[model samples]
Target: MSHFTQLRTKITELEHLVAALADVGYATVETHDEARPLRGYQGDRRRQRAHVIVRRQHVGAASNDLGFERQEDGTFRAWISEYDVRELGAGWLGRVEARYAYHATRATLARQGFSVAREETDRDGTVRLVLTRQATGF
Candidate 1:
């Protein structure tokens, strides 16, 4: 499969893997949200809300199992599943889940103020993109 295709495929797999783990006890499912367009807009306007769940281990309802830290240009990157893994339970799936988390994070960040500058496949067929931070309040 192509790099982007591979990434996308792996991303889809990880999405399920995350939930499966939560179901089996590999990890606790935190926030699982589906982002979709809610209203009319100039473009494809959409949003995502948290879908909270657990692996029968946690006592309280929590948020997304992922964590994102903003880069210098405002692009947020993270292997958030790994974060939750330590607190919960994660294995090889952590790495894959991280990809899905990143995609969701990128979208959410862009709406908050960060904008993706470019996205292209690398020489090795790997995908990469740039996101910049602009004064979105203005």
Candidate 2:
């Protein structure tokens, strides 16, 4: 039996989401143009599908696959098994979200010709970034 739970998230960009996963140590995440099936506890394919997936092998021996589906509004929704959630703990998602925001902000700033002048993280996991842009002469 499958025990996947759907969770909504504010992640709207696929590239940022992938990069965020990598930043959080999930380097082998799979991305597809269309949603693909997720595996269950027994390595059986479940009916649920997602555009971005972290395979069961990467999660744990007893854990099911982790997935993120793209929504109509361009955001992604997470589909994580209840078993995996307990294994990963509650803070797992929060960390991913925080990293997502970090990457998104950095990418946006880079596009605007801004460079990261300083970056730091507190003991409490709070990230601070300082950006600067070169002055253009007329």
Candidate 3:
């Protein structure tokens, strides 16, 4: 494939991963140090293997609703917000926080939707997975 196609595929794979995360009640991202203390979930720092991270019900000054950005320092950021969350969060994502991420990614990927083939709930109550994609007519 061409370079652009490869890049698009990579992006879609990453988006799919994130959308799958949203289907549950969690995401895989981090926030700025300044924004960190504001979170309700000051989650465990140990054993998180992260490249791109998710932030639900958390936002920043320059954030776009359900925004995606890559820092020069190489962190991938993804999120859902109050406004967009209500529109996309659904089905498995039954909570307010989950719904926000669902709706946010839904609009961001009009032609594509997320997939959840597997969900493993750890002893710590964290869900890890290998997500795919699907086409929903709703």
Candidate 4:
């Protein structure tokens, strides 16, 4: 028996979520306007609307489907089978979120003509990113 688990996330933009997934090596395919149920092993399914479907190839042999649903509040939530969580490790969400943040921040800064000046990761898993913009003298 497979049950759909709701993994709450702070991702509002679908592009950011997709980028995050790609960053983590999950190939995603965009679905249509209507939400489709994610099929699972043993005929388990969820009647949820998923904007993007993360292909099952990442989880080989399992019928577990992973997708993202948009909430009324505009944030997106992860809809995945419980089996995937167990197989993909409990830190899956964290890893995705970290990537999302990384991409989002980089995009935001790039739009403002800022580039990464320095990047470093500490022993405590803290990342320090320094941004810089070209100086234009009037």
When summed lDDT is taken over every stretch of 10 residues in candidate 3, the lowest stretch is 1-10
* Candidates 3 and 4 compared by lDDT, better number: 4
Instruction: Please give each candidate's TM-score.
Output: 0.26, 0.95, 0.22, 0.84
| Poorest stretch of ten by lDDT in candidate 2 | 56-65
lDDT (CA) per prediction: 0.39, 0.91, 0.38, 0.79
Give the clashing pairs for model 1: 32-51
Best by TM-score: 2
Pick the winner on TM-score between candidates 2 and 3. Answer: 2
How much is 47 displaced in model 1, in angstroms? 34
Q: Which stretches of candidate 1 lie over 4 Å from their true place?
A: 1-95, 121-127, 134-138
Model 1 has an lDDT value of 0.39
lDDT of 4 by residue, 1-138 (tens): 677799899988778888888877776566546677776664455575587786566555774778888889988888877888888889888988888898888899998899998999888657799888988799
Q: What is the lDDT of residue 50 in candidate 4?
A: 85
- How many clashes (backbone N, Cα, C below 3 Å) per candidate? 1, 0, 8, 1
What is the Cα-based TM-score of model 4?
Answer: 0.84
Instruction: Kindly list the per-residue Cα lDDT of model 1 for residues 7-105, writing each as its tens digit.
Output: 112333334444444544446554434322221112222231223333222422332233222234533233322234444454434444544455556
Assess candidate 3 and give its lDDT: 0.38
**lDDT of candidate 2 at residue 112, scale 0 to 100:** 91
Query: Residue 138 deviation, candidate 4, in Å?
Result: 4.6
Output the better candidate (1/4) by lDDT: 4
Candidate 3 TM-score over all chains jointly: 0.22
Q: Which residue runs does candidate 3 get wrong by more than 4 Å?
A: 1-16, 19-65, 85-138
